[model samples]
Target: MLAAQRRDLLLARLRQDQRVVAKDVAAELDVSEDTIRRDLRDLAAAGLCQRVYGGALPASPAVADYPTRRGVGVASKQRVAAAAAALIQPGTTVVVDGGTTALAVIQVLPTTLAATVVTHSPTVAAALAQHPAVEVYLLGGRLFKHSVVTCGAAAVEAAQAVNADVFLLGVTGVHPDAGLTTGDADEAAMKRALARRSADTYVLASAEKIGAASRFTVLPITAVAGIVTDAPADDDTVRRLTEADIPIIHA
Candidate 1:
């Protein structure tokens, strides 16, 4: 196929599947993996896709909006969220990061628990507001249009001031070596600040995020006290994390 036709085909597949693997494209198009990689690089350069370790995802999924993302992995996120929320104790301060998974955690919070929730996510703050016993503190900063989360220096500073019992961090990608990373650099920075200010930090991830890497690094896996994921506890991935001394709570 011609270069233009090949690029169009690749983009169409990405739109349909939300991701594209180089090997799959190369085999389908009868081209070398290098050719597929070059196509992906060009697409990424044009801001049409975000290249990942072995594939590429749509530059920004349509559900990049907080409310939309909240519905994407509703079941998995709820399971993970319930597990994370169970760790919260009454009258303790908690920091929730911005992600659909974290929003799920807020949704399942008990109505009777008394606590303060500091967050950069407007969606999370809105969810927590429904609980009469919880105090929601929404940080101020530049809003990220796609995620609808406040980020930047102001948000980071606000996160640093609150000493919380736990910080439930949402990760874009978590690998054994790459640790934690996010698509947005500012969000990663804010998460790091939240981790540093909290007494304990727990990462919430889905099975797909494991073994993945993103653009910006947040912290090493060892930095977190625990991880809550939808993957099986005894899976090789979870076992590796457990061996590192970080407790794994499989939902």
Candidate 2:
């Protein structure tokens, strides 16, 4: 087949499967792996897909700006939020990450609950203003406008002084093989720093994040305490996570 025909077929496969392995696509197309690689490279350049280690994912899965994401997965995020908020026991210090999902967790937190909540998101800090019993500490750093979170030396340094009972992490993608990933490198570093200071860390993800991969990896799947998602236990991504022995909490 012509190069154009091959590329078109590959895109179709990517749309259907959300991912396409180089070796598998090459075999199906009866083409050399080199040819498939070139097609993938061209597609990535055109912003049609994203190139990963052994395959390609449909565009970038790192997510859009905060407002856009807040509207993307409302129900799933709310479910995940409720489940995450349940993990926070009264009087314990908790580190909350920034994201719509993380904000949702803050929203669902019990009004009567008493705890110390530390976060890098100004939005999260403001949300806790009405919670009389909750102590709020906002980590300071250079503001990242896209996600509306703080990152940089100041944020990482501040995280060092915090020792929390639990860290509620929010990410753009979660995959058993790719691990937990986000859109920005600095944000990933900040998250790693928080995870190190926490007794346990749990990822809050919607179904769209499952099986997806992003630009920067925060932690390996094993490093996290467990995953809380809206995807069913029987979903393919959940099965993959379970097979890896990572705990899955269906929200």
Candidate 3:
């Protein structure tokens, strides 16, 4: 088959199965493994798939820009946010990540719930301004406008002083193999810094993130205490996570 036809087949398989193994596709198409790998490489370069060892996984749609993400998964974000909001204890401090889902958590939190929140997202910090009892600390740094979060050496340094009870993390994708991932490398580093300062970190994963992969990995699934998601129990990603004994906090 032509390279274009082979790539089309790879995309079809990806949409159907959420992943494509190079060897399996090669054998099925009666082509060399190198040919299949080349097709996969082109697909990855085109932002259609995330290349992994011997295969590729579906890329996430959640990597869209800040304003665009506001509309991507509204209801699912509410569900996951509600569950994540419940994880913050009454008097404990929490480090909240930046994203639409994290902003949803701020909305779901009770007005009178007393707590401390440290965040790098100006949007998240502003949303918490109306909270009667919660103390908000906005980390200062060069703003990464893609996700509307602050990141750089300055934000990383500020995060070092934070010793929080928990960290609510947001990422672009949550695949069993690719682990926790985001679209930007520096944003991924900032997330890791915050996770390190908190006693426990819980990922805010709406249904859309499951089964997807991104360019930069933030952390492995095992690094987190649990993942808070509204994705169905029978979802392929959820099923894979379950089989691996990963603790999932369902919304």
lDDT of each: 0.80, 0.88, 0.94
lDDT of 2 by residue, 1-251 (tens): 99899889988987667688999989987889999999999988876776898878765444688877877878988999999999999989999999888989999998899999999999999999999789999999999999999999999999999999999999888876678888889999999999999999999988878877777889999998999999889777688789889998888
Report model 3's TM-score to 2 decimal places.
0.95
lDDT tens readout by residue for model 1, 1-251: 89899899888886565568899889887899999889889988886766878777655332245666665667877888889999889989998888888878888888899988888888888887779899988988999877778889888877767888999998766666557777778878888888888999999887656545567789998888888888777655567777887778888
Name the weakest run of 10 consecutive residues (lDDT summed) in model 1. Answer: 58-67
Best by TM-score: 3
Which stretches in model 1 have alpha-carbon errors above 4 Å? Answer: 1-68
lDDT of 3 by residue, 148-213 (tens): 999999999999999999999999999988999999999999999999999999999999899899
Candidate rank order under lDDT? 3, 2, 1
How does each model score on TM-score?
0.76, 0.93, 0.95
Tell how far residue 178 is off in model 1, in angstroms: 1.7
lDDT for position 226 in model 3: 93
Among all windows of ten consecutive residues in candidate 3, which has the lowest summed lDDT?
A: 9-18
TM-score of 2: 0.93
Clashing pairs in 2: none
